[model samples]
Target chain A: MARELTHGASADSVGTRPRVAAQPFLRRNVPILALIGLLVVSGVYFSLASDTFLTLGNFLNIVRQSAPALILAVSMTMVMTTRGIDLSVGSLTAMVGGVGAVLMRDGWSVWAAIVVMCAIGVVAGSVNGFFVAYQGIPAFIVTLAGFTAFRGIALILTEGFSIPMRDERFVWLGQGTIRNVPVPVVIALVFGIIGWLVFNKTPFGMRLVAVGSNPEATRRSGVNTAALLLRVYVISGLAAAVAAIVIAARLGAGSSNAGLGLELEVITGVVLGGTSLFGGIGTMTGSLLGVFLIAMIANGLILLRLDPFYVPVVQGRFSWARCGCTPMWRVSATLRRDSF
Target chain B: MVTPEEHEDGGSVPGLDTPEPDDFVLQASDLTKSFGSVAALRGATLELRAGEVLGVVGDNGAGKSTLIKTLSGVVAPDRGTIFFAGELVHFSSPRAARSLGIETVYQDLALCEHLTVARNLYLGRELTRHGLPWLDDRRMARSAEQFLERLGIVAVPGDAVVRNLSGGQRQAVAVAKAVAFSPRVLILDEPTAALGVREVEQVLDLVRRVRADGVGVILITHRMQDLFEVCDRLLIMYEGTDIARLTTKNTTLEEIVYYIDGGSGREHQRAGSITSAS
Candidate 1:
């Protein structure tokens, strides 16, 4: 024990060692690069298979159709990065759209309906956040409850009927175009860019990652982890509202069935984009690429006139194949158990 | 009430007496905490001085962790007074304590494995553009590099993900993060546990350097040898109470182990007989 106190031992062994080399660019971006390659291959296949696949009109159509899911994926990426899930998103979309359409059909101004719907989104998201962040409930469980309850509420709002929206101003939100770009596509792009900046360039984004990576560690570092998580759920809820508005205006109806099975689709795209299911890792670029890839598949399949049921089957297969083949998935799995 | 003089050499024992109040850089008296009906800490006390390394040792469930938690503001005490530099302070949160120059490196290391070393080093306290939310990643990386280099930690590249580092390297990074801000009172909880021989030596050497910078360090560990190596004084906790405070040179491993095993009842019988006879 006394010998351990020898003051002569080199304390600066760390100072004199050679610097380790940084990770190579390719190795770090393998997942992103792989997704890009897949996207290109799929593009070539679709273009060769269908005359409409490569047209600018078809490209804008695909972006328009994908706008809602893209917006949802942006928020989902943040949620999943914290090792949480908002299973209620699909149902939330229905509730917001259905309720907002009812308000507008009954003579509520379009802007007023939009404002109220956004507030609803905030309230619903806060409920989920309160339970998960403040009450210490698992996010999956809390949002699962939301999934069931919100859908029921949507059904109640519309009385199980699809109400037609007659407001031209509201209809423009979904169908209008700017310089040939669909309104939905424009909104998606704006949200996507903002999401990217918030996820990559800000202190809040960095802290969000830290919260997902190690909540206790982040808390010890003097961060308000609970507040951060609450904000994430709120964003998810708000995104669902925005998505709801787009879906309703595009369809020109407030149907209780809006965004049906949309949550799984968004999750699939996000996970395929290289975001881990267990939390702590996310890439905004990867998520966008993933959402675009899914949109391509849906559009290409329709152009080929395949059975609509085949779409999900193919998407499911793609997810498994992507997860199975990528070395990154293996890394994510190892990280959760921290076998390293 | 006899006032004890300061021991500049850190080689004198203060048996059955407390050091002068003003001599302590950090002073906590009668700290008590409870989780439900279970009392984790019952009237624990500790004193630390600048440029000194105080080792806290106790058996499992001896409340050493609870005491440290209370001091670090992770858990508020039910009853206690913590005076930092002779000013009574209340810590509502770890952030509050941190603002006053107190930093703690928990036993878990708290490094985000998926993030790069630089990101983890600046995890919560990221450097951002003035009045803007954008991260100054370039500056943070540069500063992280300098921090690691200054600590002689070259094996860990600033850009490397923490998950890929070895256990020793991870510990080194954790220490570097703690010392980066030059905290006044740094509390380390079992920093060298489960580390390799060379790694343990590196950590101890790092502790020596931190103390040389005139910071008061509180080292809590189960490793007895580590205490003798880096700790200036030993504060023994028994059943949630600090029963003995002895200079490192004046106490033997046997005495520390005895006190840790609930030997406070025999303090008078063994005190002068053990080492003060000289």
Candidate 2:
């Protein structure tokens, strides 16, 4: 909003402003710009570390692998935008993936299994929404419960066994290429487009940001804030469920633990991309960049002959870097606020 | 939809008071509300006239908030009637009140600072293209620009975020938002409470301007100076009811203080019921 610092019209004293000055571009869009910079820096760093990292094949490989996570990250951005978190997404993916696999293995049609999986996702999201919205339970508590209980449901459904998916078409949906681009990647792109449009252009998008920005004010504006909040969770659950199908099909198996720590990964991408942990500030493009950045870092380290464990070590650090980003953003945002 | 001209021709209901100096836009009579044992509004009555700025002044907790909340339908008066444009209306909610051209601007609750000025202007009521969810952003920006222009607020750009606005500009945007709906009755609660000198002057001028546009403005404030500046009539509240109703032109600041400090006037028996001022 205050994109031009030099032309800033602080003009007078009114409400208290942060007593610091910052470049307007960096002040307003630190997350997106920082993520882009991070992406380039990491790309260059990785390419130098491993000769094959800069190759087009390896880059697409990262895209193909990060599709499910990227897709889910889109939904997490929506959830996090409303200052709500869906911790159960990982468990949700596990349950849906396991169920879809179990259904496909039992000779059910792939299309029918997909429909059933969507229904499961809706119900799961609705449950989380109801407890968080209608029942007045804090989202952190309810989703935290989902994080624990939904995985248990998945474990019970699969009996801790992995189901093999043999459907050729189903596998192709995840693994096949369309015009030399992976299908999951294409699907992720579609989700990203729709998510971006919804967050930027639609009235629903404005309301979502308003709800996150100031719930009391939005409610007083005569909006059905509770309904919007509930719908956001439903969207997150639906995304996770769909991503589950992709994950299962891509691996040719649906395990009860298909997406262990996946919630963390999606959140890492969303937060690392500069989406404010303090709600009301997020970007779909930022999350997309963040997903690729994480994917590249993980891929690059593995290609560099580092232990596979180093990926998580790096990922954990990247995610926690969000906490650091918060303070940085605060200082800079305050600085920007005062600049004009 | 009734025009100001049609209202002046006596739209069926004649003014209850003589001289007809006040053509009531909205009249709240004997409104009462209670929270548990505490009575917030005890038969509080006030009238807002078309093209007039009626200021309601009282110390904190004198049921000023409750009275306006009841009139604006944020609170359901346990006993009262709110007549809007001579039509008896039941404001079941604030939305219902707004639907009947009654708008309330609460302190700092009107604008979402994170949103753009155009977005804030059309927050709850955004225009859509092709009747779809796609917001008509350009249309909104154009209209918001025109709306601010009409209000004579030039400092704020339509694209600027409310967060970047000066306190005065933000207040203007909030008022502009309410004005965009072409409301018949606008209620401003402590409009100048947190503003600086110049910003407060801007808001006071805005009140005068909004009143000139035939919108009956109910200005709830405690600033005596502000009451003198833009208000047409001053309604002073003591305890839970109206203590004095004085026309701003004929009344002095000293008399307002007398009623504010609880003096026994024409309604002596009722006014004398409260022995202590505070």
Candidate 3:
């Protein structure tokens, strides 16, 4: 190594390179901490308001209820990190789950039904990925069109009727517990860990952020930015497929309405977790926390007997508040450049 | 830590042994490009030798940028032939040119703001660990630290974020990224445009160091004084034509400026027109 160019008495302070991130831990994680606080405060109030809300059984139910969002939000964090959103995923969940339920109703083997459902998810995701990645369309616009078109397709496929399922194996995926944890929750946990390693320790993860930060620059570096963008959407679709399988099993039926408004739900959780909507910044850990936080919020709202419409209104407001406030104090780019 | 080139000799192109006695590091001839009816380049030519810094200066829309883009392979020229390392070459994309040891640092610097210095240095081409498919962050980090220290760049840590670095520091990182690969030709577009005096000097020092290792450097800028400070020769582009070429030792700022202004007295230094330095 070349000898260090000693410039001043302070050896560690060099150029704009910060000393171990001058921003304290408190500032960096303030939003996440705030969400956790919100979760606890809301959890407490609801437990006091209703006798059943505080029970261990209800808490497990909340975990089960959150399983789909938890799984999809992990991949959603990946998509948003690249500054691309996947709005079609909610409709995709309904379509895939509805198809799976239909397959079971027709007497198909559970394994075959699950495999076909996963394939459908991958293909459906590719449709959105194709236009957004290869055609250079904005993700929001492509997925918005997909959001409507996919729902319509699901409606046509199910004929607006719920297809009831009666498979024990399928039901096990949603309701079965592993060592006191719900099966879906367990699966979601595995996905979260894998998502973390992939994002933090792989070249694909680094490339994703690089593309998000500046696609032109990343392309100049010889990376295929378009292809990277495509793979990301595909991953989001695959996650949706798994979520669909679990949701269908839990409800004992598949309907076009299975994941109505779910796109907003998971997207809200992802943004709330500190993944920048503008792209290039994402965290799996933050997404996990945000997903659980939303699940708890939903449980609390139901126990309090608040109007159903307030769920989205309150969720959107909380997410907007945290995202709006956090970057001002946390992100260095926001502090130094103020371009944000 | 400086190399053996002690004096800042601007124009004395060192004679080096090669199979082709008249071989230039890079020679682009009669290049022409057009965006609609506006001809970006009419007929421009450039010649650079190993261990030399050639300054390219011109007004906006004078085709200096077009010339750089052509050589760097950012776009296919409407008409031209580029002879690099003594072989005729055609580049469909910048990556093609880069693989043949040709690299360009554009005006934006091309660094991802969120990436660490090490990752930025090896963004497109990252090394894997123990032959596995995963990126070897620790190896990249350690090597990045070593290279920066060798280049006398210690202000920024290998793990530091690129967005957090100052203008000059970011410029150093960009130059260092190109230099680490040891390319035969390195082209920089206005690296000192937004830098402070000290920062400019830091960049110039790195340029001088790279030239010491026999890499041909092309600097395109509007800063006239900077041309005199480091360029061995000045290639002046005026209205999309290569009308003047002057060895830095044999020319003045006034003469270069006159060429830049498209004066009547300008002449293209074609074959057998080399001026003798007094």
**Which numbered prediction scores highest in TM-score against the true structure?**
1
Write one digit per residue (lDDT tens) for candidate 1, span B1-278.
Answer: 21123333443434435567987889999999999999999999998888788999888899988998888888999998999999998888887887777888889898888878878887767777775778877666666765676666435677778777777778878877777776899999988775778778777878877787778899998777788887888899988899887778888876887687688567665654445322
- After superposition of all CA atoms, the RMSD between model 3 and the true structure is 5.6
Go through the candidates in order and give each one's DockQ: 0.33, 0.23, 0.33
* Better-scoring candidate (lDDT), 1 or 2: 1
TM-score of chain A of each: 0.91, 0.89, 0.87
lDDT over C-alpha atoms for residue B7 of model 2:
28
Error of 1 at A173 (Å): 1.4
Better of 1 and 3 by lDDT: 1
Q: Is candidate 1 or candidate 2 better by DockQ?
A: 1
Per-prediction fnat? 0.45, 0.25, 0.34
lDDT of 2 by residue, A1-340 (tens): 1011111223332223222221356567866766676678777888888889988888889988888889888888888888888899999999999889888888899899999999999999999998877887888899999999988988998899887898899999888999998888888889889999998899888988887888877766666778888999999889988899889889888888888989988888888886766788878888888888888889999999999977788867766654565677678766655655
Give the whole-model CA lDDT for all candidates, comma-separated. Answer: 0.83, 0.78, 0.80
Tens digit of per-residue lDDT, candidate 1, span A177-207 = 9998999999999999999999989877888
Model 3 chain A scores worst on lDDT over the 10 consecutive residues at A1-10
